[model samples]
Target: MNQTKKYLVVGLGRSGVSAAEALLRYGAEVSVYDKKTQDEIEAPLVNYLKTQQVTCYLGTDPSDLGRYDAIVVSPGVPLDLPFLQKAKTLDVEIIGELELAYRLGKGNYIAITGTNGKTTTTTLVGEIFKNAKRKTAVVGNIGIAVTSTALVAQDDSWLVTECSSFQLETTEKFHPVVCALLNITPDHLDRHKTLENYAKAKAKVFKNQTEKDFFVVNYDDPVAYHLIQECRSTIIPFSRKSILEKGVFVKDNRIIVKDQSQNEIDICGVDELVIPGQHNLENALAACGIAYFCGISAEMISKTLREFQGVEHRLEFCAEVGGVRFVNDSKGTNPDASIKAIEAMKGNIVLIAGGYDKNSKFDEFIQAFDGKVKALVLLGATAPKIRETAERFGYQTIFDEKDMGECVKRSFSLAEPGDTVLLSPACASWDMYSSYEQRGKHFKSCVQELER
Candidate 1:
């Protein structure tokens, strides 16, 4: 409860740097440390830290962390690290950057967390609030760090945060007035060690909430649904399969969002959603639930849904050339997500997939193919695995490449008129790219080069 707390920021990545800067602005003694050197933390804004008199210990000794009263860890850093253990022994409170931001934010929040669709739901909810003329800010894992946004929060503003399991893992007293726990899936298992652990991490968003808070959850998701039974907060359930008279539900193609008083509003029909796939319909449902609960009108919600442009790198259409439509869905990092992307495609598809395999089961992809995929263009470390799966499934047309450019060139070669060329890699892009953004940009670059 110190007014001018000494904060130690671990992991100088996007979240880490933003949190450090915010702490300094608040008159807190800020120091940062990371395993990487100054050159490795290549953010241009991080260089400004030195001018602001912020202490930086990049690629330095762990002993430096022992001096701070509290530690704000980056989401990427492992919770079981030796430095974290040392900090705990010394009674230094260790928390994530989101937790720090939550403590600083004066406005009420609508926090969204899940394995997938968090960004979509968060963005949609923010848009609804925006259309209603509410002062709202969308931050968290989607891009802008919450800490910086909180510093400029107004009395009428609302924080619509998209939190990841990594951010939720270290949260303390970061309760949202209205929390949305979207569908939980088997993702980031490499970091969480198990599916159960990942679910537990996501559930932490509502762990400390009181009766005044509300939790919006998907009743169709087993893990998420079961967790709701254990939550102390008031629960409002939603589903794509069932009809809920008192909560958000789908009935005859239209999404009906109902409150406790049985008052209802139809935001839009599933067929009207600009974004494709059943998963996106579900995302829209979750967003409508969040927006309606936050007091956004039905009219504004409908208008925003009609005008909302879908998130980039997730089943986004690039262009049509020579009657071949190109899609960039580099955000599909798991087999389930990839399956959804494929299911959303029209006509014959030349799929460009494969990256760093995390030992996920490709059986879903194999079964979902059902002759829809005209040709399979594989790349990165998981090319062999994808090829093996395709071969095992008796898929006749399969091509392997080392990188994105080769995959695009080969896919174009095999594609005919009315065929879709999709870059929906069901694996992490770390093998050949920095992140999914790089993978998506590279795919677009190759497609443009081919056009030229």
Candidate 2:
């Protein structure tokens, strides 16, 4: 915390607000910038910042940037933007909220990152740690800003964090005690420009880890397995397809952990996991691997994994109306994730799909429907794009709606008594709602409004 430093916080999201607030507390001059106007951002927050003597640049881009020591960018803000690029050319340092938090906060971090399964894994790990009676806070891309918890975190506090590629991009010294890369599928190509770039960004999660730190990875995912080639930390690979010599994996229907000394501990049976889908099995393995390495007992890990009902918005069952089940999977923000949701569902589905266009291809997503999807209800910017792909796949049952409520209604209408209406949009919720949580909540609200 430097009193003489000045920081320009970019984007008016939670990360931006926390960064600015933390900087102000450090006696640094803080400024916040958001393209959304004060009204759009809500006046209460804007007024509060003003009362704190913080400068705010909302509605438009501010011209001056060379004066600030660095720009703390929120994850949603693209670094390649001309505004940020100009800062780079001016020799001004640019860092993300994760980096800033790492510098300002004190804690032993356990970061989980991947295209999908981050929320489930991070949440499950947090639960396991809780059962072990550790002082813990689960934060980061899952929802709670890391900076918010990090600012007040003690040196021994366990910050169980869910990370995204965007948040990992600007990290310099953001090292975690135990870093897990669950899986790296193609996602966020719009901002990253390419799959390789996105993977490189995710790779940053453990870039600063020392030899004593542990790196947990999904051995079943070739991409995640590939990442271990450059890992400096001790490797802890978890797999669903293979039994590992010294990590976490399934053996004869039970989850087992093998330590460096070749000693094995049986965590639990594969059937014990309350969460469905092979993807979730991978998540369990990853979580178990994380917990075991952190010295959490096998009994605690097993108990937590079995009791976990899975994260909300990830294949969460809302209700059965008129014998039709409604499942909310709004967290399936990418094709790979939606594919997992599809695999996890039973019976025919009236699938609600499409959202913000992330420059992602939907061929695999459409193909995953596999005659299981009776009808596809589309919404948001990617509706047309996904429809085109569905047509290309020779799958014709499709409908387009303007929003989440309409999409949920259309999905229910398309569904039969025995069918499931699943809200598993294959794109981000940004195009229609601020976030996937909001989108999920709207879907649940709309489902509740449906008559018997």
Candidate 3:
């Protein structure tokens, strides 16, 4: 945080802009770069940066890269880019936005990372800390930029951050007082390229932590359980199945936590949670474990668990039309996430699946269909790929839809009374929609139209 240090922020995204602003605020010379041209960037942000006197490099490689002391990279920028590779050779000291926030921010941090339940767990932990009267800020992949929040963070502030594999990749000294790896599954394979590499990136959340720090991990997930061997922090394992001598687990339908002191405390009943799904129960456990390590009381954690309705786009209830219920699980952008959504439902399901293929295989997703998925309504680039997988399983009830509206309508037609029409695309929404939120909203609108 030296006043005269020069910093280069790569990418003009939210994280990039926030990093640049934070560096400038700390009295550092800042330069911004993005692949997009000046016309492609937002006017307000462009004008705002101008007022700060930060140099902007658009549609080209940053000039005089060797002059900067450090380069802060946004999560979306690929590390293998030729310019970045060249920068690495020059020993420019590349770090991610999370690392930048960590270096400049003063606060206790609780970071959560996983393939499926990061947002739900991070949000739950944030709520639990707030319920305990702690000054908490929820940031990172959940939405808010950590750099922006970190700038104003007081000494007593708790930064509950949701870290993704991409963000974790470039981190070096980004340690959290409390960290959790909810569950590791095959996701972002197109980016990380391999499962081992992805898990290693996620394991970075605990890389800098000492024995004084606490690390929460999923005992149920073999991939996550394996990471325990690599972590340096005090391990707290959470499981939906089996009793644990340490960490959080469920017993006789109640959430139980066995602290570091060997004192077991009953947090809440499984029935008390407003959110459905065993996966959510696991999320709740991970959140509770984090909160417990942070000194939040069990009563406060339980209260938050019982009242928190769950995050949007994760098995969110859309509406009921003609006795068929519609659920939006657009957040299930990966096979494992969609599998959890399918397992959470009660009645027969007319599943609307498929989207932009991330080079992921769908055999496991197709196998999960079993008896619950009465009919499959497919769409987007992955439709044909999913159909092939479904046929391999000898499951034949399938409908190919051209759009989200039609996908919903087709799912409804295939659904009977007491059946659930679930929009749990096992792929990302980028094929047709900008994000999963937009896709979920459009699905809700289509369902609402059916009600009319």
For TM-score, the strongest prediction is 2
Per-residue lDDT of model 2, residues 1-452, tens digit only = 66989889998888888888888888898888998888788878988999998888887886788998999999999888888999999999999988998998899999999999999999999999988999999999998998899989998899999999989999988999999999988899889998889899999998999899999998888987898888899999998889888999889999999999999999999998899999999999999889999999989998998899998999999999989999999999999999999999888999998889999999999999988999999888998999999999899998988877788778877888999999999899887798999999999999998954
Error of model 1, residue 340, in angstroms: 1.0
Candidate 1, residues 1-452: lDDT per residue as tens digits? 46577888888778998898888878888888889887877666556878777787788746755678889999888888887898898888999988998787578888999877887888889888988988899999888888989878976779999999999999988988899988887878778889899899999999888888889999889889899867998888889999986778998889898888887777787778898888888888888878877778888888888788888899999988888999999989888888889998988999999998777768778788878898898998988888888788788688888778999999999999999999999998988887898999999999999889
In terms of lDDT, which candidate is stronger, 1 or 3? 3
Q: Write the per-residue lDDT of candidate 3 for residues 1-452, one digit (tens) a residue.
A: 57999999999888998999899889999899999999998899989989998899889898777888999999988899887888888889999999999999889999999999998988888888888999999999988999999989999999999999999999999989999998888998888899999999999999999999999999999998998898888999999999999999999999999987899999999999999998999999999899988888888888889899899999899788999999999999999999999999998999999898888899999998879999999999999999998998899989898998898878888888899999999999989997888999999999998988
Among residues 3 or more apart in sequence or in different chains, the pairs in candidate 1 whose N, CA or C atoms overlap within 3 Å are none
Score each candidate by Cα lDDT: 0.86, 0.91, 0.91
Choose the strongest candidate by lDDT. Answer: 3
Better of 1 and 3 by TM-score: 3
How many collisions between residues are there in candidate 2?
Answer: 0
Tell me the lDDT of model 1 at 315. Answer: 90
lDDT of 2: 0.91
- The runs of at least 3 residues in candidate 2 whose Cα sits more than 4 Å from the true structure, single-residue gaps closed, are none
If the candidates were sorted by their TM-score against the true structure, best first, what order would they fall in? 2, 3, 1
lDDT of 3 at 418: 98
| RMSD (CA, angstroms), candidate 1 | 1.8
